[model samples]
Target: MTLTAAQTVAALATIAGSDNVVGDPAKMGAWLYEPRKRFHQSAAAVVTPPTVEAVQAVLRWANENGTGIIAQGGNTGLVGAQVPLSGNEVILSLARLDRIRSIDTAAGVMTAEAGVILENAHKAAEAEGSMFPLWLASQGSARIGGVLSSNAGGVNVLAYGNARELTMGVEAVLADGRLYRGLNALKKDNTGYDLKDLLVGAEGTLGIITAASLKIYPLPEDYETALVNIASPEAALELFQLMRQRAGARLNAFELIPWIGLDIQMRHGMLDRDPTASASPWYALIELSRMAGTAPGALQSSLEAAFDAALISDATIAESLADRTRMWAFREQMSECQSREGASIKHDVSVPIAAVPALIGQGVTAAETLVPGIRPVPFGHMGDGNIHFNFSMPVGADPKAFMAEFDEAVHAVIYDVVLKLGGSVSAEHGIGQLKVDLLRQVKDPVALDMMRAIKTALDPKGILNPGKMLRSVP
Candidate 1:
């Protein structure tokens, strides 16, 4: 009953017009090219459904034909979730379904279709005198469906929660082509079996998210921004606690960056000028959101108290909008600046707040032991205990050889420490094709069984995003 690639394309074109189906590899660059360029297999065809009913119809046909379908949005995902795994799968993109259903400022909720860009959603919320707090560097291209499916976490997670907490309900097409309409603006609902929660972070395995009802917040009047100089991660941790006590929910961001980040930026001439005060071994970028009536200087007062407590050595408060922009650019550009140095190994992991220092300490030591002279660049949401633990290769090592030799073993060493500290291996980024085997090795057996059961109950034919987030090959 297996159809050839040509037959698959023809059938898909029949469901959604011929122009909507892309079988030619040359014209499929946008859908095939992922952020990391990790998963490069060819899809059977890329189908763009223009309407909700069309999406349902395509899914119904694919399910009956036993064709693997991968739900993709924006194609800006880091873990290859939006691209193809097996060559036989067809990619169903929600790009043409872009629409904002409704926005209610009083209710503090907005229902947007899946293909709507994250940045567009922000503008819609702002137009209504509110804010959608899920801000990411890739927001310009990332779509709401991909963000919710990954359950993305970004810079402002300290104040607002991740995508799962921000989203109230979702409307998706289940594996059997049935629509599950769970959209509502209520803050509290105690229904049987939390299906909305199940599909949010499922990475397109259970179903295809078409639209969502998301929470919104009042726009802050301004932000109190500053860059504090700390001697080490331990001091940064202490300063973080002090800021939490002073600002509480208003503390929007607390990001940790080592001095190496500044060095790379300066050498590459990426910045017009240095954004910090002189130079220091470590820095923490902190910001406090000011409400409509609240006065400024809250972050300044908090820093003064930290200085008095010897938690911080020096700090620079942003006096103007330009200063604030420069400070944020410095923190937000950490990931990109790494490429200027050379090849690097990266891990997006999290641990308990108190165990962060230990995690970084052990991770650096272990990596250096394996690859001598590997420079560690550990930075990210310090308050959230999520660190982007990355290590640049030695000065003269070849990138390909280094990755080929040390990638697997290095992961083993770092993950061992993370698991010991009761942390998650994949924090903000979901497990796409990247960590399927690792999840099998590291995840709890009971949790794995539950996930498999749920996957089976929903996608009995395994036609929805097959071989994603699960150890199917094993």
Candidate 2:
């Protein structure tokens, strides 16, 4: 039988102390409010489990009582994966499980609890003279559990990889309250089904991640950063290939930003001063990491070659640490700068690196056709072909009206083009409640069936993050 709200709270309080159970809605704001502010639903109760055993006990009770448990971390996800969907579900907050279990710099691995903040993980690695390469804008608040759950990809993905690739192993609690002690720093294991892979990007649909063994890297001596002027996306793509050919693995970041980003930032006083070299139609923020023995001037040499080929018009190499920080700030602020304009429609889509120019050109044309005078601000990891396809409403247009009329229609248009080019509709962001219908519409029927089968087999009671990723079987 399904438990009532009172019974659920009482049971959770019994498992993980009364002080840890938040039954009052007013006190649940911090866990309720997501980063995007798009999803708004009340949870039955927010329970913070202080230990892994507490988490297991809560799950055991939830499974037996048919209660929905939504695993939440720092609550910084853009999608609603960490938030509640149905009002009856209980939110299992992992905030109290913060701990850096161990750091083995010699082995290039760090084992950290799910509740450890991303920034704190970075500090721990740095303290050992190593580095956890996963870097995101929300690193200050985004916890390791949510990061690994979503398999987050940030700017450094070009050099290092996404969270899935960076993670070596994970220890998660299964739906039936059994502990899967799969944590190991093993570099290579001819393991059976690769359960770690399943849980890393599962978004808590399968199990609750307790801790993870993450791959860390030696600290780079320094980074050579620059902002180059490119005429268009096509030129930026060519420049990326050239940098890769020249610098190889040292080419850490190659980000694309349209001139509109600079304009919006300056208009809103988001930047102290312009970080680019004169005016240009587009900019590519490129960086190369230098090791201790490696020589500098690699970026300058590459830029000279780029200039020789006319792949770039002009560029400004960062002269100091302040300059490098400002250049990255411009790229990082791309998402935030859009709100200053008005309501914006956003898509995190990806296509082949060679087909990026076509994706942007055709996408922009289609968006303009749908809404006349729509301002297109397409920018992101050009090296990886994942562009943050976004469009601001026309000047003087009503934000609410624009979104009401064009949100769904605009998404349809963009996804059509993305699929046509063999791209993904949701690149970095996983399918939460927001894109459930979209996944149903675009995902392969066979793949959907497999996902549903897996969901059912793992979470037979549907008590673990119900109504997320795959729809409920029933």
Candidate 3:
């Protein structure tokens, strides 16, 4: 028989304590409330494990009882993976397990516990004379485990790669409560299977990540940032090629921003002053890392080339740290500013680098067709081809009613364009319960079969983040 919410709470309290297990719905706000506010399911209990051993004990009990369990970290995920879906699942929060276990500057590795905040990880690396490159706006709350599990990519992914690439190894507890000790700092390991790769982006469905050994890099001396005025995505893409050819690895970030983003931010007073170089149809927020012994003006020289090529009309290079901060604030605040404007439908999708223009061009046209006067806000990593393709509701439209009317219809149209251009619906964010159906529909049948088989082999009981990523049992 299935355990009641009361019984589950009692069981979890026994494993940890009454203090650690929160069954009261009112008190479970921190663990339940996600960033998007789309998922509001109540969990059976929120169990905060004080130690790795405590986490293991709770999992063992849940596994034996056939109870569902969801591993939660900082709970800052855009997707609903960190929160409970079925409401029957007990949330195994790793918040108390946060710690910077070790940092090897010479070896360029940092082993952080699952619940360590991403910002804290950065501090630890900086203290050791290195840097962890996985940066996001939610770094204040997003944890190491969740970041690795989701395989998050931020602006710097153009240079350092995403979470999966930066992660050297992981320590996770399988569904059956066996700890897989895979935290080794080996650069090259051609062992049996790529288990680390599978668990990194598995969205906590296959295993519960307890700790990770992340790749660290030498801190750049300074960064040369610019907000360049471009006519369109096509121009932005051309400018990106010029920068890649000129700056190479020093080209840390090359993001595309639309005029709509500037209009929204300025109208709402989200920024103290305009950060761009006057006004144009679009903008590209570009940054180049200046390593020790490297000269500056790499960004300036590249912009000159872009200007000569007629790809960019005007540009503003950040002369001071404050200038750089303001430029980045404009980029980072893109998602939050949309909320202030009212309801917005967002797609975190990606295509090949060359196909970004086509994706944006066709995607905007398609969304406008669905909802006349719909505002398209296509912006993000242009170099990596991941655009946070979002659409704000028509001005003064009822937010709830607009979403109710066109959410699914808009998705169908946008996703159709993404697939036709050889793009993915989910780029940075993983398929939490949000995209499971879409994944099943768009993914190759054989690839889906392989994913299901692997999930079954690793988590036979379907307890680790049940019903996430994979839709059904193999």
Candidate 4:
């Protein structure tokens, strides 16, 4: 028989501890709501297991009882992956497991508990004279477990990598409560199946990550930062190629921003001053890592070369720490400044690095065709081909009416262009409850079959994150 909400809470509290279980619905908002506020499902209860063994116990009990468990960290996920699908599920929060198990600077790895906050991990690595390079806006609250679960990518992905590439291995509790202790600092262990990759992006359907061995790198001595004005995305692409050729691995970041981003931020007083050289159609916030004893002004000289090649029009190279921070502030505040204007339809999609120009041109044209006067705010990691293609509703249009009418149709139009260009529908952001139906519509049938088979093989009971990523087989 199925247990009621009270019974489920009581059982979980007994297994873990009454003090760790939150049965009251009023207090479960933090775990239930996601960053976007798109999903608002109520969880049956929230359980914060203090130890790995406790997590295992909770999972075993959940599996046997056929209860759905949504493993969560920090609760700062953009997609609804870390939140509840059905109201009957229990949120298995990993917040209490925050700990750095070990840090081997010589090996360039840190074994951190799943609940270790991303910023804290950075501090720990910095304390050891190394750096964990995964830098996200939500790093202050986002945790290791959720970051790896989503395989998050950030601005630094150009120099470092996304969470999966940086992760060495993971220690997790399978749906059946058996611990999969695969954590290691080894660079090469061609063992069976490469299970760590499977779990890292699984969104906790296959397992609940308890700890992970993450690759850390030597700290760069300084960063040469600049904001260059570009004529268009085409020019931006050429400039990006020039940077890669010039800086090679030292090329840290290449972000593309439309002139509207600057206009919006300045209009809303988000920036102290314009960070670019002058008003241009587009901008590129570029940076290069300067190691110890390396010559400075590499980025400045690069801009000079770009000018000679006619890839850029004007530029403002950061002269001090404050200038670099302000330039980055302009790029980072692009998303929030849009909210100040009005509701915007956003897609975290990616295309080939070369086809970025075509993608933006074609996408903007299509969006305008559908909703005339819609403002296109296309920007993101130009180096990595991930553009956060977004559209601000027509000026003075009702935000709710605009989203209600165009959200679905706009997504269809954009996804069509993305697929035609051999691009991905979802890039940095993983498909959570938001894109379940979309994934089914766009994903290959054979890939879906394999995913379902793996889900069944690992979670035969279908008790882990039900109705997420892939729908119920039956």
As a TM-score, model 4 comes out at 0.99
TM-score of each: 0.98, 0.99, 0.98, 0.99
Per-residue accuracy of model 1 over 28-123 as CA lDDT, tens digit each:
889988977778988889999998888898999989999999999999888878888878899999998789899999999999999999999999
Regions of model 3 farther than 4 Å from truth: none
Name the runs in model 4 displaced over 4 angstroms: none
Q: What TM-score would you give candidate 3 relative to the actual structure?
A: 0.98
**lDDT per residue (tens digit) for residues 307-397 in model 4:** 9999998999899999999999998888888999889999999999999999999999999999999999999999999999999999999
Residues 133-153 of candidate 3: C-alpha lDDT, one tens digit per residue: 989999999999899999999
Query: How many Å off is the CA of 3 in candidate 1?
Result: 1.6
Model 2 scores worst on lDDT over the 10 consecutive residues at 465-474
All candidates: CA RMSD in angstroms?
1.1, 0.8, 1.0, 0.9
The Cα error of candidate 1 at residue 392, in Å, is 0.6
